[model samples]
Target: MSTKKISIGSKPTAKPVQPSADEWVEHRGNGNGPEPMKRLTIDIPESLHRTIKAQCAMRGTKIADEVRELLLQKYVKS
Candidate 1:
């Protein structure tokens, strides 16, 4: 067996690709910018969940947006 020494050299690293502000917001929910959002998970009956989903789809709205509007109307006093 022949003994050989391997040369160790530093390898160049490519910079990570970062999403622009709009792209970030489009993909990930805005969590770091102004008006940051927090996630809320809940359990609901399958039928009710389906109904809400269908209604939101028919109305061209998002379930989260609907829930947020309902919650704001219920709790936030004008």
Candidate 2:
């Protein structure tokens, strides 16, 4: 049996893809109006995540929708 040599070197780095301002806005816009939805990334404890998932399952809603509602209720003015 012939043994093959494996390359254990680091791979070349790729340039990051950056979105243009107009493209970014258009992509994120809701299309109803100028309401753009921004993506948010957050870290939460496993327990909290489980709780959110359970609540969403019970309500038959999405975690994002539930989180958005909660945020609006707490932050947005009536």
- Compared with the true structure, all predictions reach lDDT values of 0.90, 0.88
Going through the candidates in order, what is the number of backbone clashes in each? 0, 0
lDDT, candidate 2, at 3: 100
Give the lDDT of residue 21 in candidate 2: 94
lDDT of 1 by residue, 6-73 (tens): 98888879889887998886867545767656899999999999999999999999999999999999
Off by over 4 Å in 1: 1-33
- Give the alpha carbon lDDT tens digit for every residue of 1-78 in model 2: 999999898887997989999988677665678765688889999999999899889989999998898899999998
RMSD for each of the candidates? 8.5, 12.0
After superposing candidate 2 on the true structure, give the runs of residues whose Cα lies further than 4 Å from its correct spot: 1-34
Name every residue pair that clashes in candidate 1. none
Model 1, residue 4: displacement in angstroms? 23
